[model samples]
Target: MRASHAYFLFVGTLLTAAGYGATFLLTEHFRALGGSEIDTSTTLGGAMAGTLIGVPLVGWYAKKLKAARMGAMGAVSVAAGYGFLALLTTLTPLIALAGFLIGLGWGIFYLAGPMALSERVTDQDRGFWFTRFGAFQMAGIGFSPIVAAALVEHLGLSTRGAFGVIAGATLVAAVLLLTFEALSPQASQARAQTSNWMRALPALLSSRAIYPILMVGLGACVFSGMLTFQSSLVRGTGLEAGTFFAAYAVTVVVARFVLAPMINRADGDRASVVLLALMILGVVTAFGLVYGVPVQIASAILLGLGYGLVYTVIQTQAVNDAPPEHRSAALTWFVIAYFFGIFGFPVLGGWLIVTVGIAGFLAAVLAFAVAEMALALLRGRQTTRKPVSA
Candidate 1:
């Protein structure tokens, strides 16, 4: 790998840590401020709303801007958002604004980081590189809680103070990104000539990339539903939420790191179908069968093996399937669809968990998993019939 690639991976890890760390603490921070559940949801919703706006807006202008510059801007936005949260003493509308900044920043970074990296590798090595990058990202998310705990427990910092620390770290990421951009002036200018977003939209929506996009979106829903409500899912089962999460995280990192080459070499459509089936099995084992700690751990491992691997597979397809000039647009829409499911599904999941109980939520998750698998099969058959081109 190049020095630029190494730097991008390091900076990407730090950015993911900052974003997810702050998010992990949001609930506790709001509750500490005497905020109600509604206030907490509102704050989170604000972040989601901001992300929905930030992604497409950034994509629309992606060709005109360098990816590194966009990433820098995103880091600064996240810093500003966390900075605002650190200063807050009361649960107010301003909290929502802060959440919005964080979400918007994350949205831009999320899209720009992968978009930028995708350009750095060839189709032959894309899956390998992406899985490695994704492993780093997952490590960041998995370890963020430990980092937060250290800040509060070992360092004697308050929750608000932790937010400040994260903000400072994010700002450092911004500085590093900008410095890298400055040092590589020519590379930044080497991107394809600017193109209109309207012209690229059709390409992303075409048959070549559309199925991967849809499958990813559905896959996101499966991921969010299972992990986001894990606490609820484990209730009364005598299992700590950490048990499932830790097992899942370890499995994901191991799978991505050790299996990247194999995954990259596999048939995309067939692999997706098998992985999606694993996800379905995970949900069934966790929610459908008798509740037990062993069963929960098994479920986590299944999901880790399934979703962890499938994500990079389909994401790579989305880019490779699109025309070279429009690959960025393809990735942008892929990210948008992903976040939409990540943030949007929880609302429905929550409703189902409340109105019809966990069974309803489980049913919904199974439905999505089945649908995604079906889509993967279809995508495979389509690919077999006629190869797509850039």
Candidate 2:
């Protein structure tokens, strides 16, 4: 790997920490600012809207912007987003603006990081690097809440002060990413013959590509709801949000690091079913949180395994399985659905919290998980595309 690319991986790891560390504070911060439950959740919804806006723009300009420039911009956007959040003292619509920038930055990284990694390495090596990317992301995120707990719990830092730390971390990523050298001639030329990304939408919808989108949507919804309702779900269980997030991040890193090779080598369609099944188990275990902490811990383990593997396998399929020229376009579609889950579902979940109660929420989760599993199985049977083992 090139030195610049290696640095990209290192920076990517910190970038994850930067975005996520700030996030663990947002719900509580917003609530402290007098936000109702629905209002607090809307902050994430705004971020998802930013994602919704950013993905297509990234798709259109991906090759033109090149990876290095995008990385710099993305990192800056992250810092700015957090900076704004840190400065805010009370509830206002401006929280949405800050969330948008955060999502925009992440959205850019989601496209540019993969674009750069895949272009730099050979096809056989893509999966390995992507696996490391996931692991590093988990490590950074895992480490953050601990640090956050120290700053807030022990050091007496205000919530806003905590966000400053997040901003600094992302700025570090920006500086490192800016040092990357320009792409070589071969990469530049291949990127020049760009596909009209919009033209392929109809085809992607009808094909197997849609299945991963649907299945990942399930995972995204589960993740968003878990975080959005952290207080309510674990109210009687005596587990803090930090504990839950720490367990999740640790489990994901361990599972992904140990099992990367097996997952990367598996068929996308079939692998998705297994991943979805694991997610189903995780969701079931998660709903058991009302029962207590042991179930929550078990749920975290299952979720870490399931979510980590699903993204690696399913995303590889989205980008790698596509015709070379169309990879960015394919990723755009996946991202659209990914954010939709983040943006759309939480609002619905928020309503359930206000009205339908725990039973209603559990029922919704069950219905979604079952549907996700069925789609995964059906896709495994129906997909005609030959699987590629990296």
Candidate 3:
């Protein structure tokens, strides 16, 4: 691999891990401030909703400036948002304001980095590269919770202190991102010249690559519902709500590093089908968690494995067919789809938990997984019929 690719990948991992830490700290910090479970879920959902607002902005900015510049702005926003979070003791509007900045930074980092990485690899290698990227990206997601939890426990720091730590990490990630020469001079000029936002949308919307990508996004919706509310689902199982998130994060880490590599090494279509099936199983395991802790951990592990593979496959397939100039647009649109799922599902999960309880919430999430499984199957068959070169 090229030095720039390695650097971009490292920066992406650091950013992802920091983002994961901030996400955990925010949930715990809000709750510590006497926010209700419903309120906490809503705030998290709303913060994610802010990303929906920011993605189009990043997509637009990518047209005019180098992605590195946007990424730097994103990192600064992440640190400033977390710094603001550290200063506030009350359940103030600052939390919400900070959320918007956090969302914007996340969108820019995600949109810019992957596309830059993809540019360096060939079509036949895109799947492998995306999996490697996801693996590294998820390494951050998997490990940050343990580190953050240790920070909170060992330092006797306030939740805001933890938030500050996350902020510092994000700033370092942003600085690292800014130093890398990931974008080619020619590619940078191409992005700078293509300034019209509307023009990019049509081709993204028209691609044959969209079906499987849609499945990835929708599958993520299922994962979001579980993440936002699984604590509530695991509540009556004699495990503390805090333990649920810890377990969830740990399982996610293991699956990304362990199970995902083996699955990705297999055929992509067959592996995806298996992963979605595992997801359906995970959703079901969640329903069983209402009964006990063993089942809850099982649910976490299953879902983690399922989540680890689904996007890796979808992302691998999404960029495999697109030409280099169009690859950024393709990845941007795929992210738009992923963000839609991330944005929509939590609010719905909160409502479901409030209204139907754990069974109702898992049932609804299961439906999403089942639908995704069906889509993966159909897409697999169709892809086979056409014999895509990649």
Candidate 4:
């Protein structure tokens, strides 16, 4: 793997750190501005809605754009959003525009980052780079809040000032992306893949390669909803939310090193079943945490063990099974499905909470999970029968 590839990805992702972190801050920002909870959700949802348009474009243009170039484009979008936010004093509809731009860049940057890594290294070394990819992403997420908090608390930096700093950093990242040489001509075209994703969409979705990621939609929904709404919910069960999440993140990172290799050794079909069962176990067990802290800790560990490798397994399956020429497009589709779960179901979950209560919401999540398992089983059967060549 090229060191440059890793470096560029780390820097590229770092540029978006504030955008992701801003969502959390935006809630309080909106509240401080006298906006209702509904206003916050709507504003945030507007950002997520950008993925609806952005992801599909990424998928369609996967063949045309260099990953680094795409990342550069994303960086600019995010920086623009940051700049716009930095200039804001009062609430305005323009925040949605800024949010939308950021969201667009989010999809494009992620799509580019993975493909760039793929281009930089040999297949034998792909796992190392992919793991690193997650590490960098996690590092950005983990670092952003800490840094932003420090800036606010110690340096007396306003949120706008913090965003300005981030915006400057993002522009530098974009410059680096525009000038990078990691992607060769062939890689630039993803080996000259098909030009029309619209025609290919139907087959891509029907293919067994897409099945694992489809199941991931369910998992992403749970992850998104939990973090967005229920970050505090576990506290009611006698678990400190921070402690539980810290445990979850630690186990996830650790499992990538210790457990992901085993999943990789296993074929995609079997891997999906393993991941699905583990997530099911973890989520169900989480509800039982009212019994004790032991259960809380156990659930966190199990969830980390399960969800940690879930994406890796499905992502590997999707890329490996995709035609090499169209792999970028396939991965984009996979990512879109992921965002759908993250953005779509979380809102639905919120509605479910209001209508059916937490009990009903939990029931719905479980049912959705069961449906994912059934689909996984069906896909597993088909994939095992007709093994895909890597």
The lDDT values for all models are: 0.73, 0.70, 0.66, 0.65
**80: Cα error in model 1, Å:** 2.3
Q: Which stretches of candidate 3 lie over 4 Å from their true place?
A: 1-12, 120-129, 182-208, 240-268, 290-293, 320-328, 381-390
Please report the TM-score between candidate 3 and the true structure.
0.82
Model 3: per-residue Cα lDDT over 27-103, one tens digit each: 56777788645555555565576677666667676556666667667777767777787888788645667776676
**For model 2, what is the error of residue 94's alpha carbon versus the real structure, in angstroms, after optimal superposition?**
1.3
- Among all candidates shown, the one with the greatest lDDT: 1
Model 3 scores a C-alpha lDDT of 0.66
Ranking of candidates on TM-score, top first: 2, 1, 3, 4
lDDT per residue as tens, model 4, 1-390: 347546756666665644564444454455456664344456556667877787676555655776667777887887887788788888888877877777777767767766666676776787776776676565454355546546766899886787787778778878767656443333433442334555656767767667765777777776665544443345467555445555666677677667766777776676667777877777787667578778766766776676667777777677766666566566767787887776676557656655666667667766766777787788767764333222
Tens digits of per-residue lDDT for model 2, 1-390: 564557555665566455754565565676677775576567767778877776666666766776656766777888888899899988888888888888888777766666666666666676677777667766776567667657888999887888888888888887766655342322543452245668887767766677776777876787666655665567656777666777888888888888768776676777777777787788788777766677777877777777767776777666654666566567777777777775567678767877888668767876777887787777767666455465
Minimum summed lDDT over a 10-residue window in model 2 is located at 181-190
- Top TM-score: which candidate number? 2
Whole-model lDDT, model 2: 0.70
Q: Write the per-residue lDDT of candidate 1 for residues 294-352, one digit (tens) a residue.
A: 88889989999999888888887897788888876777778878877776676577667
How are the candidates ranked when ordered by lDDT, highest leading? 1, 2, 3, 4
Native-structure RMSD, model 2: 2.7
Superposed Cα deviation of residue 30, candidate 3 (Å) = 2.1
